[model samples]
Structures are given as structure tokens and as C-alpha cells.
Target: MSFKSLCVAFGLTLSLAACAVGNTVDYRDVVPPLGVSGSKSVAVEAVDQRPYVLAGDNTPQWVGMVRGGFGNPFGVHTVSGAPLSSDLTQSIIDSLKQGGVKAVPATARMATDRTLLVTIKNWKSDSMVTTSIYIDAEAEVRDQAGTVLARNSVQERVVNEGEVAVLPPGKLERAKAVFRRLMDQLLNSSIRDALR
Candidate 1:
């Protein structure tokens, strides 16, 4: 092959290799093992996820190493995935239902005495040598009269190395695990307290 053709072929191979490096997994599969068991009906609104940031150019590159460190060696871009708000809301609703709560998706005309609202303040994963994930958010429970019954700020962390290896290997898997843990903490603490 000529010099120009060789250069183009090399570039194409690198591009393809990069594309194959990142894994895009679904958020729906990251279900936690614990949930509240109750007959109380609850409505969960689509969570507000405006503040959440997935992998980005500014995110440290070491995080990509946890997933085999190939496609995005620099970790300059995140593997594309689902919207956080939709996935998180659905996951919460599913978990509540599994726990025996009559959980339903919130709607404008729906009649429910209790409503749950969540706003994600931060969601991030990092690695110095090993991966760690952190989440911060606010949650509120209110009654039909719009009376706030309980409110709290929630934060959780999972370390992916040594004895604290709570997360899995892929970025999508790590995200799923983080979300599951975060929701578990939210339900067991703030939301449970509010319902009482």
C-alpha cells in the first residue's frame, strides 16, 4: 500500500478499536436487594437529574482503566447510555413495588396521599488506581396537601478495590451498582422515615 493509504488504514483501525472499548449497559438491570415492605401506596415522580453528570471530558481517565482501559484510554468521553432521570425513577418504582408497596408512577391527575420527589445533585465515579463512585441528592416526601413530611440530603460511596470491591468491572455495571446502592440508602433512610 502507498504511504497515504497506510496512514488512512491505521487511523481507521484505531477509530474502530476505540469504539469497541467502551461498554454501554442498561440502567434497568441495577436492582438492589433490599426494599421496604408495606401496603401503603406511593407515587414516584420522574426524578430531576439535571445536575447529574455522566462520564465527560473532565472526568479523570483512571476511571476507564477499571473497564479494561482500551477504547477511551484517556477517558475523555463517556460511553453513551440512558437518561438518568427516567431510569432512576423506574428503578425506584420497581423496587418499591417489589417491597410490597403499591408504588405507581406519578401523574398530574393521579390521586395519592403520599408523593416522593428526588433531585440528583451529583453523581460521579473516579479512580486514583482503583475505582470509587459517589452520589449526592435530595429527597422529599409530601402529602396531598403539599405538606412536607420528610426531607433529607442523601450521599453514598462505593469503593471498587481491595476489600471494598462493591462495584463490578464495566462502567455501565459500576453505574448500575452505584444507583442501586444510592436508591437503597434513600429508601431505608429518608423515604422510610418520612412514611412513618
Candidate 2:
């Protein structure tokens, strides 16, 4: 190859290397297993018609590697190709109902016993050029009046060195599953707290 072409290739390689070296998923702290029983019930408002933030919504690339593979590796957002807010929200609502909860209709104009406002502050993912995947999320819940009820920012790390699934099924599916599971835990905790 021409000298100029070689120089360009070297520069690109260095740039990519820099990006790779910059961010690494860190889940060193031991994360205790999530022990949530669906027995408890919380008075949750009907699923809001508004879009539910997709798993890894507004997530960063670095966070992706910790949870699962990025939906769209080339896209700006790591989990960009994941379901939309509405899809995710509906999924959660349905899961909650099945698990055990009096779900209100999203269109109900009247406010119910309790309303929950969830804000997903950050979601991120990461993976090497060849293989490996993961995802993370930071979320919070508030009451109808906007009082912070509880906040949690945790990263789910699924290190894929070779051929062992951190998730039950696989990484991508596992990420989605984890998202739903996290929501379940949130509901469980919220209900337990509200009842108290």
C-alpha cells in the first residue's frame, strides 16, 4: 500500500484502539442475588399510556458491555434497536398484572390510589469489536406529587469471554429479560414500601 494510505490506516487503527481502551465495564463489587417474591401486592396506577422507556433507553456504549450486546453496534445509541417506550411499558404492565396487581387503564382520567413516575436516567452497553456484551441502567421512582420514593443505579454485567451465557438464554434476550426483571423488583419493592 502507498505510504499515505498506510499512514491513514495506522491513524484509524490508533483511534479505534483509543476508544476501546477508554471504556471498560467494571462490575467488580459482588452483586447480591435479587430475591423478590411476587406474593406482595402494590397499588400501582394502570400502565401509563405514555411510552415506557425502552431497556437501556438513552444508555451509553460503555454500559452496554456490562449488561449485553449493543442492539445496533454501529448506531449512535447502544440499544437503539431495542423496543420503543410503548412496547416496553406495555410489557411491564402486562407482567405486573400476571404477577398480581390491580392494573388501572392507562386512559383513566381520574387519579388512583397511588401513581408512580419512573425516570431512567442512564443506560449504557459495551462489547468488543469481535465478541462480548453487557448493559446497565440507573433509575428512580417518585410519587404522584413528585416525591422521590426510591432510587437505584445498578449495572448488570454479562461477561462473554467465550461461550458461557450470563443470561438465562443469551445476552440480547437476557438484557431484555433483565430489564423486565428489574421492573418487577421495582414494583415489588415499591409495593412493600407503600404498604408500610
Candidate 3:
């Protein structure tokens, strides 16, 4: 094959790889250990309201874009998979369990004393030479009667401009750290007070 032809083939291969992967981030991969336990019964739910990946409808890669994308010329945005709300919901569950909270999914049939509703106002990670993760969310503690007991908002913007975030899993690990901070911020602040 001609040298020019080889170059084209290589580019095609990289783009194809990007598409095949769909540039997604699984929230389950970012759950952190809370090291605290609670017997408090609560149901959790999350709804994503960002407009991005695939026109921001409902699908994976909602975590935001860390790097390359298939047909996306600007860049690729990471996804959560299928639907974002589900991913956030599960992530919250894992985080609560790590804290030893008797947490259950809002959609489940288990009995719960209170329900915590989380609206993902915005969650994204964009990186090229450097990576930055910005997460904004609102959490509400409600009684079994659906009365709001406490409301809290979490917004954090962290920029990892170090050489590490420019690497492979480095970017991913950076995002995980943000996820941990996000949960940590919530549980320690309003959530903790409400639970206590």
C-alpha cells in the first residue's frame, strides 16, 4: 500500500476504535468508600438534566467527555450507559452502602423511611492536555409522605492540570476522585445533618 493510503487507514482505525468504545464512563467505577455506617432507611433516586452526549436525550456517556469521540469532531463526551438517571441512582446506592446507610433504589419495592432525590444539574469531565471535572447537583431529603425535609446543593469544579491527568486511566482516576468528593461533600454537609 502507498504511504498515504497507510496513513488514512491508521486514522480510520483510531476513529473506529473511538466509536466502538462510545467514550463512556460508568458511575459504578467511581464509587468511594465512606467508612461510615448507618441503619437509617432511605430510598435514593437521581435524574440527569444535562444536554450534551447524543443531544442529551437519554443514554450512556453522560459522565462527560474525557477524550476522543467517533463522529464528534469537537470531542467525545463520556456516557453513563442506557440512561443517566439509573447510573446516578446506582452510584448513590453504592456510596450510601459504603457509609453503612440502609439505602434502596427509589424504584424498588423495599420499605423505606425517607427518600432522597438527587437531580444532576450538571456533571462533566473534559480533557485534552489537561483534564477538568465540574459537577453540580441538588439533593433533597423527604419524608415518607413526600414532604421535603432538607434541601442541599453541591457544586464543585476541579482542574487537574498535572501531567498525570494527561495519561490514560489518569483522566479516569481524576474523574473518580471528583465523584468521591461529590459524595463526600454531600454526605458530610446537609445529608449528615439530616440523617443525624
Better of 2 and 3 by lDDT: 3
What's model 2's TM-score?
Answer: 0.43
Q: Which candidate is the best by TM-score?
A: 3
Strongest candidate by lDDT: 3
User: What are the per-residue Cα lDDT tens digits for candidate 3 across 34-73?
Assistant: 4546677888888776655346453444555544433332
Q: How does model 1 score by TM-score? A: 0.63
| Candidate 2 Cα misplacement greater than 4 A, ranges | 1-83, 105-108, 124-149, 155-158, 164-170, 180-192
Residues 1-196, candidate 1: write the lDDT tens digits: 8999999988865654454354344555454744567656778864544332333433321122333223243331233344555566677778777777777778655777688887776655554335667777777899888999887776777776652333223444655576676766665565675653
Model 2: how far residue 180 lies from native, Å: 4.3
- Residue 112's lDDT within candidate 3 is 86
- Model 3 TM-score is 0.71
lDDT score of residue 157 within candidate 1: 75
Measured with C-alpha atoms, the lDDT of residue 49 in candidate 3 is 67
lDDT of each: 0.59, 0.39, 0.66
> What lDDT is reached at residue 102 by model 1?
76
